[model samples]
Target chain A: EDQVTQSPEALRLQEGESSSLNCSYTVSGLRGLFWYRQDPGKGPEFLFTLYSAGEEKEKERLKATLTKKESFLHITAPKPEDSATYLCAVPFTSGTYKYIFGTGTRLKVLA
Target chain B: DVKVTQSSRYLVKRTGEKVFLECVQDMDHENMFWYRQDPGLGLRLIYFSYDVKMKEKGDIPEGYSVSREKKERFSLILESASTNQTSMYLCASTQVNQPQHFGDGTRLSIL
Candidate 1:
């Protein structure tokens, strides 16, 4: 079965701290991976999409990198406003549009 | 910007009552999706539509049905509301092979 797992269910970082969140997957064929940031009581906001190994995308202080079996979301100089739940997702199959999502990593950046 | 709008941010319904959650996307995207998010479970697909009057069952479509009368709108209906169905319902839309854009979400509570 296709599954996505995110490590470190929760994390606390000092302002400007740098860290990476892991998203490992087990699936037949890798099509694409997505990253999202969701604040409490709000919907998820799209972050990035990585399509292949060695592929990377960045926005502001966030960077997403993809590999054969996993993806990483690296945060640089994170501020308190950057605190949110980071979620990773992969398509359920190569042909389908459905997605399998991870449990997400709750990140809190302290000032 | 792609704007996905959900009808409500919070809702309350009694058990055995029918419930409906609505979503609309401003961008002329061909694909729209509905998902329920819960603690530890992440986002589980409920239903999706590729075009007007077309629908597809998702991973967790039981006890729920969907309607897509128009290209920009998609509705999710619960046959009979249950406590287990209380969750944060999110709606998203995307173009083919593109990352999905999400709404602000609707938090539904069953009593």
Candidate 2:
């Protein structure tokens, strides 16, 4: 069975303070991993996707790195607007594109 | 931009009432998914469809059903609304082995 777990359920950071969120998973064939940002009262917005170990992708103030068993979303000098729940997901290995998602890390960037 | 649109942003219903949540994607993607979001639990896939008239049960599919009468639209149905079923519902669409695009979500409350 594929499973995903995220740590530190929530985090509070001062503006411009950097931090990292973790997502660990157990699955077969490791199709792909994805990161998304979800704001309050809204659906998740796609962020990054990593397909192989040691792969990394970055967006403004956010960088995602993936290893064999885990993935990290690093926030660099985050701002108040960067506060949101970060979710990670992996595709089902049974030839379906269905995703199994993590509980997510709720980040609060205080100004 | 790929647009996934949910039928409602907020909905209220009573126990034993039948509820329908609709999602439409203009991108002509062949995959669509329905998920429910709750605190401390990540997106739990309720159902998904890969093509017209095709549907698959996801991680948590009890008390729910889905329809995919067309390639661009999917509908999730709650046979009988319950208080425990009150949560945010999200809709997503994508192509084969690709990242998904999400709608704004519908916050449903059952009384």
Candidate 3:
């Protein structure tokens, strides 16, 4: 069975602080790994996708890095507007058109 | 931009009533997905349609059914709503093996 687990269910950070969130997974034949940000009362917004190990993608203050068994979403100098639930998901080779998602990490950045 | 539109943002209905949640995508994507988001469960896929008149079951499809009469529209049907079915429903559309675009989501509450 494919499973995804995210660490630090909640994180509170001060302005200009830096941190990283972990997303570990166990699946067969990973096709893609995705990162999304979701605010309260809204749907998730796409952020980045990593397709292979040692791959990294960046956007503004966020950088996503992928490894064989895990992925990390690194935030540098976060702001209040960056506070949201960060989710990670992986597409498997089972041809289900489905993604296995993590429980997500709620980030709260104080200004 | 790919815009996915959900029919409602907030809805309340009786437990035994039948419910319909509609979604439309203007990007003419070939894949449409239905998912329910809970507090601790992240997002669980309920159903998805690859093309017009073709549907596939996801991880949780026991209490849900879907319809795709056209390429841009997909509907989720609840034959008999239950208290356990109250959740934040999300709709998404994408091309094959591409990033997904999401709607604003519908928060459904069953009385």
Candidate 4:
């Protein structure tokens, strides 16, 4: 079965503190990985997509890196505005549109 | 910008009643998806549509049905609403092989 697991269910960091969130997967064929940020009372916002091993993408203070079996979302100098639930997902199959999502990591940035 | 619009931000329906959640995307995307997000279960796909009148069941499609009579609009219907179906329902749309864009989500409560 294809599954995605995210570590550190919750995290607290001071403003400007940097950290990385892990998303490990066990699937037959890796097609792509997606990162999203969801705020309270809102749906998730698209962050990045990594397609292959050693692939990386960045936007503002967030960076996403992908490997053969896992992906990482690294936050740099995160602000209170950046405090949200980070979710990672992978396609259920090589060419299918269905996605398997992780439980997400809730991060709180203290001012 | 891809705009995915869900019909309601919050909804309340009685148990055993029929419920409908609507979603529309303006980006002309070919794929539209419906998912429910819970505290620990993450996002579970309920159904999806690849084209007008073409629907596919997702991992958790039982007790729910979907309609996509138009290319940009998809609707999820619950035959009989249950307490377990009360969740944050999200709708998303995207082109093939592209990152999905999501709506603001509809928080549905069953009484």
Candidate 5:
């Protein structure tokens, strides 16, 4: 079974604070790793997709990095509007379009 | 912009009642998924469809079923609404291993 785990269940930060969220996965074959940001009372918004080791993608103050076994989401000087839950998912190469999701890390940015 | 839309922003159902949650995506994607989000569970996949009329059970599909009769529309059905099933339901669509675009979500409550 494909499994995903995320660290730091909850994070509180002052405005302009920087931090990183971790997403680790164990799967037979990794096709892609995805990061999403979900706000309260809304669905998740797509953030980044990391395909291969050493791959990285950035959007605004968020950067996502990928390795063989894990992915990292780095927030640089985040603002109050960046407060949301960050979710990570992995798609396996077993010809299934299913994605296994991590528990997610809730981020609260205080202004 | 590729947009995904859910039918309702909030729903209330009585116990033992059947409920349906609808989702539609404007993009011509090949895959669609339904997920339920709770406080600590992050997002749990209820079902996924790779193509029209093709459905697959996900990790937590026991109490839920899905229908994808059209390429742009997917619906999640709850056989019998339960208090435990109350949560925010999300819908997403994608092509293969690409990142998915999600709807805002439907908040369901069972009385």
Candidate 6:
């Protein structure tokens, strides 16, 4: 069975502090890994997509890296505005067009 | 900008009532999906459509049905609302190998 799991269900960091969030998966085959940020009372916003091992993508203060077993979302010097639930998702299979999503890591950056 | 729009931001209904949640994407994406999100559970797909009039059941499709009468529109229907079904409903759209774009979401409540 294909499944996704995230670590440190919640994290609290002071403004300008840096941290990393983990997403691990178990499946027969790998397709793609994705990252999303969701604010309270809102839907998720797409962040990055990683296709293969050692692949990395970056946006603003966030960076995402992927490996065979897991992916990491690294936040560098984050701000209070970046406080949100970070989600990890992957396409189930090539043709299925469905995704297996992790439970998400809720990050709170205090001012 | 790729924009996915949901018809409602919040909804309230009674148990045993039929409910419909509609989504439209302006990006001309070939794939559209319906997912129900809950805290600690992440996003669970209820259905997805690859093209007009084409639909596929997702991991949690019980008590739910979907329609994609056009390329840009997808709808999720609950045959009968239940308290347990109340959740944050999300709509997403994507093209081949592209990152999925999401709408603001619909928060549904059943009483």
User: What overall lDDT goes with each candidate model?
Assistant: 0.92, 0.92, 0.93, 0.92, 0.92, 0.91
Give model 2's TM-score versus the native structure. 0.94
Q: Lowest-lDDT window of 10 residues in candidate 6 chain A? A: A91-100
For model 3 chain A, where is the 10-residue window of minimal lDDT?
A91-100
Q: Kindly report which residue stretches of model 1 are placed more than 4 angstroms away from their true locations once superposed.
A: none
C-alpha lDDT (0 to 100) for residue B3 of candidate 5: 99
lDDT of 4 by residue, A3-103 (tens): 99998999999999999999999988787788999999899999999999999999999999998989999999999999999988877776677777889
Q: DockQ (Cα-based) per candidate? A: 0.73, 0.78, 0.73, 0.79, 0.88, 0.76
Candidate 3 per-residue C-alpha lDDT over B78-101 given as tens digits, one digit per residue, 9 for 90 to 100: 999999999999999988666788
The CAPRI category of model 2 is medium
Candidate 4: the clashing residue pairs are none
Model 3 clash pairs are none
Give the Cα error of residue A32 in candidate 2, in Å: 1.2
Per-residue lDDT of B109 in model 2: 97
RMSD of each: 1.4, 1.4, 1.3, 1.5, 1.4, 1.5
Models 1 onward score TM values of 0.94, 0.94, 0.95, 0.94, 0.94, 0.94
TM-score of 1: 0.94
Give lDDT tens digits, candidate 1, residues B1-111: 999999999999999999999999999999999999888788889998888998899989999999999899999999999999999999999876678899999999999
lDDT of 2 by residue, A1-111 (tens): 888999879999999999999999999988889899999999999999899999999988999999999999999999999999998888878777688888899999999
**TM-score for predicted model 4 compared with the true structure:** 0.94
iRMS, candidate 5, in Å: value is 0.9
- Candidate 1: lDDT over CA atoms? 0.92
Model 6 residue B74 CA deviation (Å) reads 0.4
> What is the C-alpha lDDT profile of model 3 across A22-100, one tens digit per residue?
9999988888888999999899999998989999999999999999999999999999999999998887557677777
